[model samples]
Target: MPAESDLCSLLALGPRPGRDAREGACNHGQVTADEVFFREWQARAAGETRSLARARALAEVLGVLPAGVPVLVVVGSKGKGTAATYASACLAAAGLRVGTVTSPGLRGNRDRIRVNGQAVSEAEFASLAERLERAIGSLPPRTGGYLAPTGLFTLSGVVQARERGADALVLEAGMGGLGDEVSLFRPEVVAITPIFSEHVGVLGDTPAAIATEKAGVVDALTRHVVSAPQTPAVAEALERTVEARTRKKGLVEYVEIADVPQEHLPPGLVQRAAQVGCSAALRLLEGEGLALPDAERLEAVLSTVVLPGRLSWHRVPGADTEVLADCAINGTGVAMALVTARERWANIDHVVLCLPDHKDLDGAIAALGALPVTFVRLPYERLRFTRPLPSSWEVIEAAELTPDRLAGLGRHVVALGTVYFIGQILDLVDADTTRLFTAP
Candidate 1:
């Protein structure tokens, strides 16, 4: 990887993608190279309140929002990421090319943007970044400036959609939709999953406040808003937002989770994703007059949709035990992971948890407290805000989680936390899925 100084210079001078990493250059905005630029951007975006002005300003600078491209915007505290991913799969399965952009990537920045189901390759990412260089660099640096990287990413997704002649675009909100980058797209439909009390400091202290921010995705331009089951407070908040923002008495469709067909669904969060995703997808497809998939094929697609870090498990080659992981960001999300872990594993010896310094640590610890297991704190090996390990839990370094040590535990080892941390653990373990498979 090129040094930080070199990357800073490149970021300042405008990204020069398509260069080979072998030549000590950021291989045309590849994952590793992109991180350098994203890091610099994060320094400018972190802790900043979501701003509509910022989103609009960046949109004006990019000026590449493709016309007539169907947009599906998902906003919520949980399940939105999975909903976006699953919806994209459903659309593609129905034969429409889909361009997708999501956040808090499970592995790397590349995972945040995709064509169909594949991550954007180094060349493609670089070429797009290079194409929009001037626009991205020209944005003024405000105190809590626009989340330049995210806007750039959304614009790039739109470009990819146009380039691939994608019939649709799937976007996952970076935060609450009141001023989230995704909201600027003027979505045709907004799908919100369950809402929880997150970003309380930024969004608000009450569930209604949080829900309003989420519901704000349904701007006057939105024709429809679809969502899974929601709390009473959240429901009311969303209803109010729709009533206030509807362009021509737009409809708000609240699809209950139980309504989704799940006879052949898998035993994870993907089922919830399918329920909401398929429901929202069907609404969008039917509204657009696009052909929907057959029942049998739809079932097959939903059944096989594997979203990592959502009650996901994978084994390292030759390792005796399987590693279960999830990128759940809040206390409720953490609790869901634990419940799923209990159902999948007979004897879990350790539930390794990694919570960022900014998250609800108390809520997470409370949720995990009942489990008959040990809590080990592991470092999040990426550059982000992280609180110190509490005195209660045992501390373990990421580098120390050797495959042999994990195998020695003689019980299930489930890892949970940020995407980068999970990716770092897998990297350290050098997990090679092809070598062998160990049933979890």
Candidate 2:
């Protein structure tokens, strides 16, 4: 690592005051209460990595559940949010009241927790947060002190579901499944999305090792598991972990994306992953005697499935430029985005990235292959990281990404990095943004 002055000189930008620089939110003006709540966790995680001990303590404190309420633990490296959303939405469309807990909000913290595809009202969120605070206050402090914002946010979502009389609760593990709070969840169904090379430092260094951590989400009581397609190494590791239970109970299933035709869904890697997760989830639900919606209803609901910040496309106003924004922070994500962009543009001329300081920056840049890149900074605080700026790419402030500036990059531009930055750009590009992306 470089000294503060050296780092700034190298990046052509100064790092903000660590904690006081800004809260975990976009420049969309005022800070929200939910953002404030997440900041509390940020403050507690200061200069420390999360631990299994801390996660367990936090889960014990917030583990209250309504009798017979089923939880579906969505576990994986990437696409967990989209997968959970699809499963929840599909199940809900089938007449079951569904509540989902997602991470790294698209709009704000309000998008973190939802029931029946809608964020809970601000008042309801406030009330649930207040109750959670009180409950958390009653627990004994950790020896070193820690906070699990995902756990708190997740539990609050479940509490909201209980209050609203929900039939199912979908929980996503923010990180590795082993130590993450969702591991404590008594899940009736555990759904594993695609495994990607991420969090290698914290989870493990290899694909098989990471798969083991992911397989930890399934326990003895877990009646069923629905997994998206995986590479051979990932499959071996996952099978090794689940072998004992499988031999005794015969309860492991896989859903291959190759089997699912993508002609009806939105065209993208994210949508394909969603289809895989939804297909597996549907199979599991059917086996469990849950009556899923008819083919027509499922088609209608899936036709409206919106995957924001994942190779989402848009045509910029007042120009013929085609813009695609993605939350591809890691090398693999960036590589996939580049491939898809190449597929669309034939020869992608300009690549805009806003990766945080902690990602595989060299790998991400290398994944750009021959395409030129322009580096920009976004709000990187508690959630994800950004890499130190490379001396080669042009560095610009987050506010510098105006419409006219982007329009000049090329006839086709692929913008990627963090969801925070992509969402911010979407906000700047179009004002009538109801969802994460503007209507094309």
Candidate 3:
């Protein structure tokens, strides 16, 4: 068997549609080179002298690139990817060529890179990865040392996206700003979606600390800083950070998202956040003399925008049950998800949950605990951490899992928590047709 490094090389060798004699049979016409490369790269980085520092330094180096095109850097505790997607979609709707780069894809590796609201093809991703590897290999080691291949790869994607003629690029920052790869590129506009408590160990133990970490993106901005309405503690932290930095460098302009008002918000908060992001984006474009449709048209276009996996609903195949896979793993997200679920599925009887190891387990339990529903815990095979899950909930094994089994328990099965669990469960439910709808 080839070594992991060899596997990375083979996968990076461009997306071949058919089975290769050298590599095994192709799954879905292409292998995921980025996944293979990142996994190996992450493993190597983990073994290095200073993994976190190395990751951050590498991300910083990768973040800096030749500038010309407009860039939108989205940073926050949650809703970063969704906000980025909405921005990309809005730009595309306005007839502008836009590219978006996000992490932890839902379906396939190609889902991480999208142009004009469509995932780049496997062949394109493979070619880009190969080119990126070569570029990183050629760069000289800095006196202060250089970043790793993962950060370099991320930077390469941004550069590639720009090279593809993207009028604007929507870049989502990694977990935090200080060391996140996205912070390297000095964005023309920096947008913070919303602050929440997650990644406590790395960012800090409190919401204020987390906010300060996220506020690092604001420092890298050359033009404008757009922030979502944050909690008092978070807002104070952000204000302190921004004020201290702006005093040193008077080029940054901070724009509070609240200044835009809830009335200007596009019907739903999710949609409103998206519109606000696009509004900030449009304002950036307008400064560059880019023509955009009238306000009414832009608002209309935003009204049609849709984001999947956040309160995403679909009908179960065999059962007359409806399933909701909301990507709300933290406290605030869980609260929002519960509210949305209650409004949409007033008659829901059962709620299925599969939370990530990183989620606020206590908060999640409390949120669900209040619901007048029986809870069935889904399998946690794919999750990294599993200890924090509630003890009283029923655990369903993968083999024994079926829509009929779920239907036998209650009328509606609303699956909330991690997106991965929802994705996995949905796939299984789709494949089994025996558990068809009997009587509504």
Cα RMSDs, all models: 6.8, 6.2, 8.0
Instruction: Tell me the tens digit of each residue's lDDT in model 1 across 1-440.
Output: 11221221223222211111113443443644465335445564345433457557656766654336888898887677778877777777677778888765444455667877777776777777666665556767656543445555666777777787878888887666756667778788888887877556557778789888778777666777887767888888888888788754437777755434667444555566556766777778888998887766666665656666567676755866777777655667777777777788776777776665666767777777745333344332332345554465666654455566556655576777755455544543443311111111
The clash count of every prediction, one per candidate, is: 2, 6, 3
Clashing pairs in 3: 58-147, 318-436, 318-437
What clash pairs does model 1 have? 18-28, 357-387
lDDT per residue as tens, model 3, 118-195: 667777878776665554455554333234333444565676677678777888775666556666666777777777
Error of 2 at 26 (Å): 8.3
Better of 1 and 2 by TM-score: 1
User: TM-score for all predictions?
Assistant: 0.79, 0.79, 0.75
True-structure lDDT of candidate 3: 0.57
Where does candidate 2 clash, by residue pair?
Answer: 356-385, 356-386, 356-387, 357-386, 357-387, 358-386
Between prediction 2 and prediction 3, the one with superior TM-score is 2
lDDT of 2 by residue, 66-137 (tens): 325777888887778777877776776577787778875564456777877777666777687677666667
Top candidate when judged by TM-score against the true structure: 1
TM-score: model 3 vs. ground truth? 0.75
If candidate 3 were superposed on the true structure by all CA atoms, what would the RMSD be? Answer: 8.0
